[model samples]
Target: MMLYPSIMKLMEKTGSRYSLVIATAKRAREIEAAAQETKNVDGARSISKAATEIADGTVVVFDADDADSADEVFED
Candidate 1:
């Protein structure tokens, strides 16, 4: 993924209060490693599980296949 200035801007705007969960099965380790390099974002492997309990309201940002899994997480 191309690094974008707007993403950093959004993170700065939100501050450390929000959790940033990256939902990727294969790249979980890499994602976590990269997230560690970032100063204040909390990273996790499971998007569905993490989304339900984010300190702030969750933002589910993922690729197409993972989007379908959100229904399972958010359904009543």
Candidate 2:
């Protein structure tokens, strides 16, 4: 069958091309390194799993606002 979620759909979730690229690559590495613990089933390639997670919104991409808030939490 065709891919479950189109690239555009995944891109929309990420918001920007650079963010999409960064998120997908980081997720692919996570899947490859921890396939059993990850949402991806055994034998699935990392890239596919990454794409699927992005489409499903399982991976949250933190932007500048999120980072600023995070810093506030850690600051004295």
Candidate 3:
């Protein structure tokens, strides 16, 4: 239930609440892992960092049904 307004925008982009949750949770876990492995991480909490990443378009979320679409949305 990370209900930041900015994060709501990301939810709209993903077109599914479940997808947004998955993305945010995954990013939060990464942030936590990074904190464990290093210091000087700018002092942002993992949940906040996750929301900011979504709001800033630094991360993209895709629905489970959209596997093919994911490739296009996330081109290398």
Candidate 4:
């Protein structure tokens, strides 16, 4: 079966399988929380939506090691 936003493509952005998983899960949680507050459900799975965002470059993984400071760990 074909996977939209294939894992390899996501790894290209995240640099590793582990990083890709971390980034995807974090974004998915954010999407879920927002949906809860807004009382909105677009009928799309949170995980898939998050993956799409990463694939489209709308979301990114900010590695703490690559940051200039501790506070710069995560970015929008």
| Pairs that collide, model 1 | none
lDDT of 2 at 67: 92
After TM-score superposition, the amount by which residue 3's alpha carbon in candidate 4 deviates from its true location, in angstroms, is 1.1
Q: How well does candidate 4 match the true structure, expressed as C-alpha RMSD?
A: 3.0
Q: What's the lDDT for all of these models?
A: 0.41, 0.78, 0.78, 0.86
Global CA lDDT of candidate 2, please? 0.78
Show model 2 residue runs off by greater than 4 Å. 36-41, 69-76
Candidate 1 per-residue lDDT over residues 9-40, each given as its tens digit: 43443343232333223234544556678744
Determine the backbone clash count of candidate 1.
0
- Residue 14, candidate 1: alpha-carbon lDDT: 33
Instruction: Tell me the RMSD of model 2 versus the true structure.
Output: 4.6
Worst 10 residues of 4 by lDDT: 67-76
Worst 10 residues of 1 by lDDT: 17-26
User: Cα deviation in Å at residue 56, candidate 3?
Assistant: 1.3
Give per-residue CA lDDT, model 2, range 1-76, as digits (tens): 4376687898788788888889889998877778566655677677777888888978767676689875775585
Candidates 1 and 3: which is better by TM-score? 3
Q: How accurate is candidate 4 locally (lDDT)?
A: 0.86
1-76 per-residue lDDT for model 4 (tens digits): 4398998888888898888888899999999999999999999999999999999999877665876653554442
After superposing candidate 3 on the true structure, give the runs of residues whose Cα lies further than 4 Å from its correct spot: 1-7, 72-76
